[model samples]
Target: MKRTLVVGVDGSPESRAAADWAAREAVRRDLPLRVVHAWLWQPLAYPLAQNRDAEARLAEDILKETEGDLSHRYPGLTLTAEVLAELPVPALLRAAEDAEMLALGTRGHGALAGFLLGSYGQQVIAAAKCPVVSVRSAHGRPVALPEQGEVVVGQQGGVADSSEVLRFAFEAAAAADAPLRAVRAWNSPPVYGYSLGPMWSADQFGGLEPYEKAALEQALEPWRLKYPEVEVVEHVEQGGGGHVLLTAASDARLLVVGRRVRESSVGVRVGSVAHAVLHHSVCPVAVVPHP
Candidate 1:
């Protein structure tokens, strides 16, 4: 694994917290922390009317200002800061490609209270090229992954593909010493199976509960194959995906989910699953980008 760590620094209190957390992660993982700040400049209708040099300078200043506490707080972690003129997400995405893990703070957008992921953290988690760790500003002081807590994987069974997800999930499970619960949610009535037609008997759906449970076992196959030493607690239930994940996240340490992969494309899809978890999970979420 690439040992370099990357973090998004946006001059907000949350971003500052993220830097502190990221530094601690670097120290824990024995890696270097690369702090990145992105700034966007609006253009005029006619063309390059106003200058962006000033904006760039201000962005650089913010990066410097964000480093205030690192010398005293995180001296051992190697810190590198850069200012990009592009949008936050893409800039951070490029940074993540070379990083083993990307750490970020949860910043809220809507009027709702508490420390939820803001727009920037949501975007980064969705499309990051590597595992992106979304840290809560109000929790986990040192920013390390939980040593003894739940590691819940948002499993949707066959709907979500790839053993990579399970691999990442189990890796977290091993790291936390927390029992891993492979969660797969199923609800009544097909959400969009219009062409499949209706079922004949309620007993037909009776097998679904068992089938879902078996699917969880099947999903665990590759994970077990890779890491037989890691023990997992399988959770196959019927409910909404986001709700189930969040409910399972209660007092949990780390919630792991795969970045939604498109059918034909190489990049990730930043879909509702990611958005929902990023904006709502009480604990930090680890978004494992599809490889």
Candidate 2:
């Protein structure tokens, strides 16, 4: 399936880096690239209902110049450019309506990106209709190579949340010619709270681990048959679910996650954990719908 990728460029060094990245990515997937540069009419300056006469023109000129440069630089790649008269964040979000993925460059050059998602990138990711990627270097840096081989996607087991995360994970893995690591987390019951009536009986505890393991296998069975090409790495681990997912993400090019609060096409809200992972994951995070 050919995916449409939209990338934002404000002509900043980082944005240029994003352009390069987007070019390479589009080529890898045989997808088209749409480059967007946004301009807004400044609302007011102090007590005055402001003047955007000069600023708007300048912004448009910059976008046009940058678009021309990108066209020359990525000659073989399919490209499209647009200059928006709307705010960068909202404009990008609107553009994303038809895009499969939205890409951006991290705007800050300091040591604090951990706490700062650039104003434009932040707003777009918070409510974007599709997955968003914020690049670290947009200009002279080398574009990130597409996933080398089968990419690995994390899967939690048995729990409803895990089931939801798996569908997106497997679909993405297949798209990238990657593998799916169907992960199931397990842990011993708390030592102090073990004697809760009949629930903690020796017989129940004795068969618990084996039963849970079977359940996990059962959950992944259909997926295994459906996507025989996706190398399935079933990881049954003893640790926290989030932590296990993070560890598995180390070698993955992209991690696909799902939100619990599924929305209609218009009101999609990527759930909190998925949001948190996006901010913290070392690789790109793709938030998928699992409702």
Candidate 3:
């Protein structure tokens, strides 16, 4: 179980793009790359000739093609390809259990439009043992990352559980030599109003904004000191966390979100904000599970 970056590929343009992203990421981390494709055999009612053989060949073909292209593109990089006879979610989860990070395509072949990430991709993201990054096809974004693009992360008021997410974002920014934007979203309590006048006007916020700004700064202070070379930007906005993070990540290189682990739950526990961003982020999205 040597450290490696695992990518799920299925011969689609989106998966290929994810593989490309993972290759570059592997190079960045100086780790080996593992490309995996999952295939399950379905038993026909009458069982004429089994298509299992053909499907297995196809899976091998996809794996080999990906391995060849990646090897050529990233010379001197260690890469392995595997075709697992298991369902996509379980297969990917197992492969990623020992990986530094798992990279997945936003959608698969014959994906329905309007869904930011396909169903299979979502399941894997919700269950992966390591950090999972959802990457879109090259055409999903412009050829060049936007000039204002940075590694944006949702700061959960600098909670102890969010340190992993913030650290991941800062490291990514440092790797890209880009800035890290920490966004903290807050909402003020609503006040009952009368027809004559509106209740709880802007003045009622009463230093709440400053308090949020201070909290954001305090959460980021240690990260800033540790990664002094990485420029840090703090944004405290008034709105739902999901919307704030989505808007800020529009031009970002990567959006990192944290998932708090709940022992009472049977599987990984993903919050509403993390779920929202996973379904709508324009750039690559990373989900880091934290206790």
Instruction: In candidate 1, list every pair of residues with a backbone clash.
Output: 107-118
Q: How close is every model to the real structure, measured as TM-score?
A: 0.73, 0.68, 0.84
Per-candidate clashes, comma-separated: 1, 6, 0
**Candidate with the greatest lDDT versus the true structure:** 3
Which pairs clash in model 3? none
Whole-model Cα lDDT of every candidate shown, in order: 0.69, 0.63, 0.79
Report model 1's TM-score to 2 decimal places. 0.73
Question: Which residue pairs overlap in candidate 2's backbone?
Answer: 16-138, 17-138, 17-139, 18-138, 150-178, 151-178
Candidate 3 lDDT, 10-115, residue by residue in tens: 8877778788888887887778999988877767689477666776787789889999999999997889999877877888999998898999888657221211
Measure candidate 1: CA RMSD. Answer: 6.0
Model 2, span 233-267: residue lDDT tens: 77777776567666777666766665444455666
TM-score (C-alpha, index-matched) for candidate 3: 0.84
Looking at candidate 2, the ten consecutive residues that score lowest on lDDT are 108-117
What's the lDDT of the predicted structure labeled candidate 3? 0.79
- From the highest TM-score down, the ranking of the candidates is 3, 1, 2
Best by TM-score: 3
Ten contiguous residues minimizing lDDT sum, candidate 1: 108-117
